[model samples]
Every structure is written in C-alpha cells, then in structure tokens.
Target: MKHPRLFLHVQEPALAAQLLQSAVVKRFIVVKSSDAAPWSEQLLQQSCDLAFIQADQHSEADYQQLLSSNILAEMDFIFVSDGNPEPWLDKLMRSGAGYHFRQPLDMVCILDTLQDFYQQLSSTQQQVKANNSMLDQFGLLVGSSRSMLKLYRTLRKVAVTEANILIVGESGAGKELVANTVHLASYRAEQPFIAINCGALSPELVDSELFGHTKGAFTGALRDHQGVFAQAEGGTLFLDEVTEMPIEQQVKLLRVLESGEYRPVGSDKCRQANVRIVAATNRDPQQAISDGLLREDLYFRLAQFPVVVPPLRDRNDDIVGLAQHFLAYRNAQEQQQKQLSTATLQLIAEHRWPGNVRELKHAVERAYILADKMIEPDHLLLEMALADTTETELNEVPAGVPLEQLEKAAILNTLEQNAGNKTDSAQQLGISVKTLYNKLEKYQQTEP
Candidate 1:
C-alpha cells in the first residue's frame, strides 16, 4: 500500500507510455522494465503490486518465462489487449490472469477495475502493521514466507470467483484447511461448507454419497437421503481425496460439474447442483491421471483455479514459528504456562517435516502433553530422533529418483522399520494411519 507499484509490460510502447503518463495512474508507483527484459529477482523482491501486460504471443512467451522463473505464482497479472477477447482470453485465464481489459489505454476504466484492489491493499497494510498477522495476511494460515505469500496471492484471487478449486499438496500439508479458508473468504461463507472424503466412502455407495439416493434405492435407503451436493446446496462442497473416488462416480461428478444437473439414485427428477466444489488430493495429479486414478476431464473441471499448497519442507522458514503458534494455542486452551526448550526449538527447525503442518502441530501437541514447564526434543518423538537413537534406517532415496518418488520411498522404509505395523509406521512418519494406508494402497496398485 506504500505507493502501490504498477508495472506495465505492454507490447506497444505508446500505450505503455500513455498509461505511465496518465494522471489517473499517477497515484501508483508506475515502473516499466527499462529494457522490457524478463523480470529479475531484484524486481520481484521489491514486490510489484499490479501488472499490465499485452495479451499476445510475445506476452504469452514472457508469461511462460515468468512461470518457469517461479515468479508467476506470486504475481497478479491484468492482461491488456487492443482488440477482441479471442485467441488469448482462455489462455490467459488458464494462466491465472483474473482480468483481460481491451486497451486503447482507458485509465479511468483501469482505475475502476482496480479500485477494490487498491482499497484492499490499503486495508491489509493498516491491519497488519507489525511483522505480520496470520488472518489478516492469509485466511487461517500462519506464516509470511515467500511460498505462503504466493499462496495468499492465489487464494485472494480465486476465493471470490465461483469456479471450482482443486488444491494440490502432499499429505498433512493442510489442503482441507486451505479449502476451508477459501470457502470462508468467499461469498458463500455464511452457507454450509460440507466436506466428504472420496477415498473413505464405500465404493458401492459413492454415487449416493455425492448425489444422494431416493427411498428404496438400496437396502439401507429406508428414506430419501441427501448427499454432499444436496447437503452443501448454495455453498461449497469440499471433496477431499477426490482422485481416489471410484471412476464411475468420477464420471457422475464430472457430468454434474459440466451440466449442473444430477439425478438422484432411483429418481427420475433432476436436481440442480447449486454448490461450489473445492477438491484436494495428496497425489501428483498428472501421475494419478496417467495411472487412471483420476480422469483428466474431471481434473480439468475441478481445477479451474488450481492451488498448490507448499509442503512443510518447502516452508522451512515457518517451521519454528508454526510450532510456537501451536504451543501458544495449547497454553491458552489449558491455562498453563508451557514453553519449548532451546534444544527442542533447534530440533523442530532442523527436521524435515515430511508430514507437513499437521505433523508439526501433532509433534508440538505431543510435546506439550509430555512436558511440565519446558518441552524438550525427546518429547517430539520425531523420526530423526528415533533414527539417531536406534537402528531405524534413514529415509534414503536413490541418487537420481524423481522428487515425487522420495516420499513414497520414505514411507515404505518407515513401514519396514516398524515391522509392517501400520499404526506404528504412521506414528514414526508423523502422519495419520489412514494416510499411510492410502499411500500404500496407491503404491500397491502401481507396482508392475
């Protein structure tokens, strides 16, 4: 909010100059790339607020470059054009641009489109006057790391839209929490936010679970039942582990998503599905699609606004802070003065939380329960400590394995260390037994 910075990367020099020189845009700290080169690290570190880029092949190339450069996720681009909304509109939207304004360079119109954005920035600056505040910065999530900040930018853009959102993250990365925050930030906040785990549902009852079943549809259908779609009418339906849904049910779900109409089991009448969908998966979606776990069409429909939640390992900067937050929360809840010992803090900071935030939170809670005044590292029961103290094998990956393969290898090795005891394996890995089972099941299906 400190003199809102706006970068103009329009293809036309005159249009860029016109927008730059306009009195209406004078309130912004307008910056044009001196040589109109690709955005450098220094420029992004300074945090550009708004960007106007020409919607053409050149801009598309530049946009892809920014994406490859890892800066696209942190940016909010407003594609500008001198013509109709053809050819590039779909491409732009798919690339995450929320607005595509036809240009002859209308300054007043630009201001109108950005009025809310400006005020929102000002409001956020005022509310988060210190180092940062969690709720003010991002919905329900704590941290000011670059990845979290990138996530916040994505959330703010997509939350207001009616499109279905697909949240991708590793297990325990808090996908459901992210989905809940998106729901709370949206217009449907006051309405019911129903959640269902597609993987947990009985495969035979999957359809009924999603679209409800009429009376006498099955042996247990004593009366007509409302499924998640009906239960979340006019609100959001959060579909956790969506990739695990039966293929047949995925077909039904995709039909409903595309047509907005669904017929209940054993019912002739079609019901309107007035529900927003927010789905999440722990798997690599492309891998799932390749393995026939998730339908590509359905994935496309669900991922109108795809949100990638950063793994805990990727958010190293927020590790200790998040642990402290959990400790403080527990202290508040139990009316006790408990604190983490310095050594414990170091352990929390160094260990790679493969189980992500959920693991960290659980570790802190376990420590809180085990300790009196000062929580020590032993209270954490972390895998690293077990490996150091016992003959437990380290989570070693092959020299050239893909990044996605590391977690699976770690899980298998842990399960072996615990003598195939699922619960013990899951505990050692800092994940739920269910998550461990799910990963195992998924792996079992893929082995040749």
Candidate 2:
C-alpha cells in the first residue's frame, strides 16, 4: 500500500508551482534549483522512487552533476524539456532516464504515465519476490559438473513444456528437487504442486489415496475424500516411486492420463482433472515390463519427456558447490557461521555419494550440528570403498556378466522392492521406461 515517492526538479518556480497543482504531482516535492549540484547530492541520499527533471534553461554544471549522480542507478527519471526531444531524448534514455516528456504536458497524460509506471513497478516487485522465495526455499541444484550442467539445461527446456515428464535417477539423487524446479518454472507456477510417494502406500490403499474414495468405500473409508488428482487440479502432481504402483492402480492412472477423468473409489461419477503429471523412480522400468511386472502402454504414457538425473558421484565437480550451499543453509539455520575445511572438501570429492543429494544434505546438517567450528575431513562419515559394491554386485554374473544381464537384475531388484510395479520402479530408478527398456533388451541379448 506504500505509494512511490516522486521528486520534481525545475529552474522555473512558476512552472514548478503549476505542475504541483496537478493532482498527479501533488504528492511530489518540487524544488526550484539554481544548479543541479545540490539536487543531485540530495537525490543520491534520498530514497527517490522516481524523478522528474525540467531540462529547459539548465546550466552545463547542472547537466554534468546530474549525469554523474549515482542516484540515477536506483531512480527512474523522466525529463521535461521544451521543444522537440529528438536528439536529447536518446541521450537521456541512455543515461538511465526512464522517459522524456516534451513541453505543454497534459495533466491527464502525466497522470496516465505515473499510473503505468507504478503498475509496472508493482509487477516487477512481485516477480522479484517470487524468484527470491524460490531460491531461498529450493536453492539451486548446486553442481558445476558437465553432467549436472547437461541436466540443468535439459530441466530448463523441459520446464517450458507441459509434457508428462518421467525422471529416472538413483535414490537420494534429488529427484524431488528436479520436480520442484519444473513446477517453479512452468506456466502453472501459481498453482499447487503436490508430491506423493507411490511406494509408501499398499496396493489396496494406493488406489483410494490417488483416486480418492467415498464414505464406506472400504474398511477405513469414514468419509468421502478428494484424491491427489482432484487436489492438484489446474496444477501439477509429482508421483515419486511410481513403479511401486500396483498393476490395478497403473490401469486407473493410465485411464486418468488418457481421458483426464477419474472416479472416486466407491463412486461411479467421473470427475475431470486438469493436472500435469511428473513421475520419478530410482529403478529401471523397462526391465519391469519385460519381467511382466509393469504394463508397456502405461510406461510409454508417463514418459512423454524422459529426463535422467545423474548421481553425485558421477558429477564430481558439483561437490564443493553443493557442500558450500548446504553449509551456508545450515549456518543460517543455526545462527552460527562455520566454514568447510579444504581437507573436508577433498574428502567429500573423493567419496562416492551413494545416497546422492538427499544424503549429502543430511550429512551436512549432521556435521553442522556436531562440529563446533570448522567442518574437517574427520567430520565426514562416508564409506568410500563400499560405495559402488551394491551397483557392482547387481551387475556381476557367474563368470562374464553382460551389460543387459546387469540391467535386468537392477530392474528386477527395484520391481521386487516395489512389489512388481513398473511405474513405481521407474520413479525409484530415476530413468524413463524407454531408457529402462533399452537396457533391458541389451541385457536380455547377453543372456548365455
């Protein structure tokens, strides 16, 4: 509700008084300046939101002082000059003036210009507030590695589209962060962005939870409920660990995707949903389909635009940046400033981050709480040697294991954990079913 402050500088006291008579300029301070030097100095100290300077009969020293004032950087200035503004207008604009007004200025036009300026300023302030909130809450993905840069570029491009995105990556790889960035950048940014973990729910409950259910729909259906689809109307729904969704639930999800309509569990009436779908998994979905754990059609539907988020170990260059980012965040929370030691950074870079970003975040938080001053190498508790063992064991065979064999094993492990569902598996793996299938086929062919 705060109004912008406008300062008017004029050499003619009569004209300045007349301009002040206008309702639009009534709130402004009109100054009759003999030279621009005093006005320029005052402009630098005062929080002037906008400035109106009369350019008719101005001294050369006044012009020089006005041009050199640093206040111009923060204030939007308009020049009121007699005669045509053809030549000087461009110069004023280049010198940071907002606009140029010729002589015989209509009061109505001045009012309209002021209104427009305020409106634009309000809009810009809102945008800046929103951007700052996003950065404060979500922070950057925090990586300078080539793989991370590729992921960042891909995320930016994908955010502009309204496609059904399928994110595939290992557990703890910040899949949810990617989902958040997409929602923040997308057109539906002003709407709700809801995230649900499919693997956390049982097969029987997932249907009711996702599609909603009516009172007496099942054992615990005390009352009618709105599902995630309904809750995320006109927004986005992020389904995490999607491959864990049961085969029955997958069919229901596919129907929703295809028709944009879904019925509550115990209700026959179908409701419309205008929601964007973005699913993530840390498991290979293609292997789930080959193993008869996932449906092929559903896999393709959710993978309209598939993006793979690389793990932390794979993007080594992002370690220091991410570590520093987390450290700063923790420092802010604790109200205590602490820096990470060089040795700690080196150790962190050398260690294989199996848990990915989530794990790294937790580790930093823990270190911040435990360490009294600087975070040293000893503060980090990562098991370096055993980091790749799980992935390696999943890849090995009796003697010579084919690439496809390893992929199938990885997929099967994820499917079993997810109870034989591909959507949830793909969400867990953080890769599209298309990519999952490519690995599946490659592994199948290597079966001796």
Candidate 3:
C-alpha cells in the first residue's frame, strides 16, 4: 500500500518541529503550513490522505470556515490539543474527525495510534476498491456518481437516527436497496429487516401483510401470522411502491408512523411498533399526492429525510464503472473470465442508460454470455445502434465531407442518441469499441 500524504496544521513552532521529527512523520508524506496560505489550499495542492490539526490553536471562526468549505472531506482529521479541545473543536470531532491526541506529545503513543489508523484506512480503501470492481454492489447501492455519493453521505448521517426515510426514484433504481442500507447501518442492524411491496398485494391483503392477522381472522387464516410491522420490530420495515397503497391503508400507515402503534386484523389489542419505517416509490411523491394515490398528510410524515435516487442517464461517470463491475461479477459467478474491450468500454460509456443501473448490469451480463474471452461491441445488443445505421453504410458516405470527419460525426451522433453509451455506438457503427476509441483518440489529436 502507498504511504499516506499528510498535512500538519500546527501553528506552534516547537510542537511543529517536534511532530516533523517524530517517528510517525517518517511513515507519511507531511506538508506543513509554511506561511499565511490557507491550510485547505496547501492540502488541496497535493492528494492528501490524512491531516493533523491543532484545533485548539485555530480560532472558532477559522475552524468553522474550514469545515464549511469541506476541504478535508476526502481525508481523516486527527486533532491534537494541549488539553481537552474547546467546545467548538469537540463538536468538530463529534461531527466527523476520527481521533484526538492530547498534548505533552507522546511520540511512541502517537506512532502506535497512527499505525492503527493507517491500517484501518488501508483496509477501508481496499474494501472500497473491491466494491467498485463489482460496481453494482457497494454499501447497499452501486454508484460513484456525484448524486449517488451525496445520497450515500446523507444515508450515513440519517442511518444512526430514528428518522423515517422516503426514497423517491424510478423503478429498478434501487429504492429498496437504499432502505436496506439504512437499516444495516443503523443500531437496529442485528434485528430483522422485512420488506413488502405495496403494489404487489391487494388492498385487503396489504393490511394483513403489514399488520398480520389472528387465528381464523379470515378464510385460510388458520394460525396467527406476525405482520411486517411486528416481524421487523427493532429493525426496519421497507415499504416498496408505497404510492400503490390504498387510501385507507395509507391512513393506517400514517397513524402507525405517528403513534408507533398498530392493531392486527382480527385482534383489537394494539401492539407497539418498534420498527423504523422506510417508504419508497418510483412515482413523484407530489404527483402521487395530486393524483390521490398517496395521502398528502402521510407524505409529510414519511419524508423525514427524502433521498432521491438519480437515474442512470443522470449518472454519466458511473456507467463504464458499473458495466465493468457487472462483467467481472458475472465472470466470478459463472467461472468465466470475459472482459470488455477498450472500444466496447467507450460504447458502454456513451449510451444513455434509460433503465439506469439495472439496465446497464443486465446488458453487460447478456453481452458477457455471448462473447468469447473479450466482449466486443457487437455482443451488446442495443436496439438504438441497429436502428441508426440501417440506411447509412460506411461506403455510402456523402461526397465533399472528409471520410474521417463523416466517420467521427457518425460515431458522435450515435453516442449522443445512446446517451454516451459507447458499446451501443460502436455496435451501431460496425466497429470494435477499441477501434472506435482509437479513431476518436486520433480525431482528438488532429482536432486539438
């Protein structure tokens, strides 16, 4: 593993000198604040892995400004103070900083702590790399897009709390996955996590499924059945396609969320609801409320923390990463080692993933199964590619237009249509994805 790049924000000359010559200093690449330049600037100038800040030395305003800027978001901060940190610095530690080192610098102790921290950081990075390699399966959802990363951060914060969450996204965008992630991240992780699709069941059964039924409650109700609310006690109950719930059921759900109490279908005795509620839907919550599909009052009650899952089209940077991850995952599962060619990667990157991550994964898997050692562009059966090139063959290029320019236009046009999915564009152009990438690379060289 590479050594960590570190920043020292110690303002005291003697302490700074001590830290600079410390045993831990030899383990990392450390940059100290030399002049009046902002610590964030110094840190950003290079790829910093971690930072040690003398929180007590900085003013409250300076500390707050540093935090508000979010300059240290990607790295861990270790605060060193002469004594207990000031209230504001303590709050900072509570907010996100991992460790605190008290003053009267214990070099040996500091080195040991630093070693432990490095080990942990290295382990976490490896896990993230592994997760990214798989793409679709990471921290409950697979995505590296800005929207997805923001969603992950939000979930991490909201998970430890008891707040209800509303996940709004398109179908197959992994709303239930978000719910599961929250549950697993929370203190209730050891308990059960029960999920029920509100759209999949009838109105009558929806009530029974969520709240359970007593013995002989209805026809074929032989024994008492624990409802999802009870089954998910001490954990979470994920309500999928929540908009599909009947108005009457919505009222009950709202009541349950509000009072944390519910009744079985046949039993009058009310049971305490210990499970956290996580509701999700593909439809717009506001539109659903306008259409009377979702209760307006219940919408407010469930949306304690609303998380919107971005569609595949909106996450352009994540397409290739997710596609490759899907391919590797398939190879692992089926004992096959198929890989995507460079040209194919470009096509995959260019195509608009209308179905989002779900569509991308399925498409990659389909192509992987058909290809030999390398999954070429043709293996990716994109309908848009076939439709685009049906009339314009390569040899039928119009006169006066340079052949290279025409080829570039065709490639670019196909890419635009497919929303930058390179796999589809390459397939449509009757070329390998690698060849398409090469041509584009050469065009960039000539054009630039």
Query: What C-alpha lDDT values do all the predictions have?
Result: 0.73, 0.67, 0.72
lDDT of 2 at 74: 48
Error of 2 at 411 (Å): 25
Residues 1-448 of candidate 2: C-alpha lDDT, one tens digit per residue: 4456677777667777767777666544444334535666666656656777776543345556655654443457777777654444555455445667777877567667776545433312221122112111222355545475445546655675678999998877778778878888878889998888776667768878788999998897899998899888888999987887777778888988999889899998989989999999888889878876667898899998788889887876566667777776566665878888888888777767666775566556546644679987745544322224465543322345455433554564554344344566777788876465455435334421
**Candidate 3: segments with Cα more than 4 A from true spot:** 1-126, 129-138, 145-147, 384-448
Model 1 residue runs over 4 Å out of place are 1-30, 33-49, 52-73, 77-137, 384-448
* Candidate with the greatest lDDT versus the true structure: 1
Worst 10 residues of 2 by lDDT: 127-136
Candidate 2 ranges with C-alpha deviation above 4 Å: 1-140, 384-448
Question: Relative to the unseen true structure, what is the Cα RMSD of model 1?
Answer: 10.4
Per-residue lDDT of model 1, residues 317-403, tens digit only: 678878887777778777998988999999999988777776777678656655679998877767543345453332231245565
RMSD of each: 10.4, 16.9, 12.5
- Cα displacement (angstroms), candidate 2, residue 322, comes to 0.9
lDDT of 3 by residue, 225-299 (tens): 998999998889998778887788899888898898999999989999998889998889999989999999999
Error of 3 at 330 (Å): 1.4
TM-score of each: 0.68, 0.56, 0.65
